[model samples]
Target: MTPSQIAAFCLQLPGAREDLKWGSNRVFSVAGNKMFAILDFLDEGRGGLAFKVDSDLFLGYVDRPGISPAPYLARAHWIALQRPYPMGAEELRAALTRSHQLVVARLPKRLRLGLLLDPA
Candidate 1:
């Protein structure tokens, strides 16, 4: 997906918010400050995208063309897409949704319940 489409998708997730960080990078987070995805506008050519991935699948994802371990965050099982074309748009959306869920699952019980009850 294009950057704007990706941004819109991320923001539609329950309690998800976006912030511009490190100048041109757009950071998407849930439950106040736990980031689930990031879009780097400064990358040459098409922007770069990164998101959390299931730990067991991290290595497998990074082995794919155009996918790499996210800088400084890979140890936590995050993967960066140098270009969004490595996966189809629908697959990218599914991965983004999974990333959001994974981050939400790690949040405190009360916060998760609040998100479910009132996503505004």
Candidate 2:
């Protein structure tokens, strides 16, 4: 998916927001604190996307074409594109949504509740 489309999907999650980080890269985080995804535009129709993923499913993705363990974050169960991603847009969107939920789930119970009650 295009970066804009991916960003739009990420922002649809509760408490998700965008921030620029690591120079030109764009990051998506929950509750303005925990990051779930990152986008780096390489050229027209080509870019890198990375996100947290379930430990159980991590190996399966990494074995697939164009998927790899995310730099620095892979030890924590994150997956990244080995190149400008080559995959179904829907699958990426679903992964983005799941990544957002995973980050949200790890928030402190009180904080997660607060985010859910008032996502603004």
- For this target, which candidate reaches the highest lDDT against the unseen true structure? 1
Candidate 2: tens digits of C-alpha lDDT, residues 63-98: 998788888889989887834466788878788888
* Candidate 1 least-lDDT 10 residues: 111-120
Instruction: Give the alpha-carbon lDDT of every model.
Output: 0.87, 0.79
Q: Which ten residues in a row have the lowest lDDT in candidate 2?
A: 40-49
Q: Clashes in candidate 1: how many?
A: 0
Query: lDDT tens digits, residues 12-118, model 1?
Result: 98899999888888999988899999987447436799999999999999999989898889999999887645999999999999999888888888998877823
For every candidate, C-alpha RMSD to the true structure in Å = 2.7, 3.3
**Runs in model 2 lying further than 4 Å from the true structure:** 41-46, 82-84, 117-120
